[model samples]
Target: MTGRLFGQGEVGSSDLIREAAKRAGAKLLEYELDAQFRCSGSDGFINWVDNTLDIRRTANVLWKREDVYEFRVMDSVQELEHAIRQKAAEGSARLVAGFCWPWSNPNGDGSLVKDVQVGTWAMPWNAKPDAGHLGAGIPKSNFWASDPGGLEQVGCVYTAQGFEFDYVGIIFGPDLRYDWEKNIWVGDKKHSFDSVVKKSGDRFVDLVKNTYRVLFTRGIKGCYVHFMDEGTRKFFQSRLE
Candidate 1:
């Protein structure tokens, strides 16, 4: 398990398993799985994400593997969505975002409400609970990651986790940003839409960071991203440069 990639308010189960074995007087055997299965098997891309997010310090301070694994930052969310749509034509692709928008239920007519809005661009969150009579091609929330109709909506971390796509489009929300003056990543609960994560007190920042770390690493072949915060976008761009 990638311990550092744990989601908001999540506690690793590895320790619990080890403790249970000790109490039962049984030896616990552990093996580290380091082989890369995601990001086109580019471990360097993963390391670069870890270092870039300040999740851990690693030798990969710069990402120079665009030829092997596609990574691009778009100036606008419109471009991000367009790119993802183009990739989806070739293979699997989905757009995901931080939990920074309230997920409203489907409209009375069974159409999803456009809740994820960025400037002039807007898209609905994946189907909500008991979303009855969805339009012809829209998939239910559970199948959003695998279904072709999923491209019509935006996926949150809850639905996107444990799912890998050939191409991923990520919207970096305002819940977390890089504070240029302080030289640190700041988590602002006021900008967060997740109630549980926002109330994490001192751990809010780490949880928010982990949430993005998970979102950013969901692509197997490429990741296209648009940041809601300019400072955060610049910070990531600087690392690539």
Candidate 2:
């Protein structure tokens, strides 16, 4: 228990952990996750960009109290997927990723995380499209079990934690949205079918924020989001602008 437990400050919802670490005399080091071209996940490859990385800021940078990332907000899912396809066809897709379930909320149009291709498994889970919370679709499995080099299939938090990629396409659904009148993000458990999220209740908002926080930070280079809720999309767009 006394041993230091280190974590990435950029993604983890570990404020308490970091505070405790500071009390324990640990020095926190910051690194920039700014999207840049890289060949491999190996330190040797990452080292090649270290000079550039050291001078940059994180892709998900916090300005004031809002989180910001240099990104392209696609007008539609089709347009978003097209961008994904381009990254893939260019060989850079080796580390490009897609996120969220085909259906983020049941009440809304049941959408799938389009794989942007056919005939090959973009990720390990692509081989099993019919696996998930319900035994019939993409399984809500752990990222550790995933094929490290895989990139085609969409990855949820469970399959993406503690991992970083060159690029990620986030499909933000209606389950989490913004209330302009209230000026606060609200979490609707009923909209989410995920067992863990549905049961969060009072803690739902925190969980939702962390969920997206974890997802958004998965990309070391950049992220593009297709928000299902126009309100939320507009809210984010306003901030980015």
lDDT for each candidate structure: 0.87, 0.49
Please give the lDDT score at residue 56 for candidate 1. Answer: 94
> Best candidate, lDDT-wise?
1
Candidate 1's residue-wise lDDT over 1-241, tens digit each? 4444443334667888788889999988887767747888888888898888899999999887445898999999999999999999999999999998998877777788899999989999999746778877889877888788899999988878877899999999999999999988999888888888988899999998899888888999999999999999999999884
Pairs that collide in candidate 1 are none
Estimate TM-scores for all models: 0.84, 0.53
Off by over 4 Å in 2: 1-69, 91-152
Question: In model 2, what lDDT does residue 224 have?
Answer: 68
Distance (Å) between predicted and true CA of 7, model 2? 15
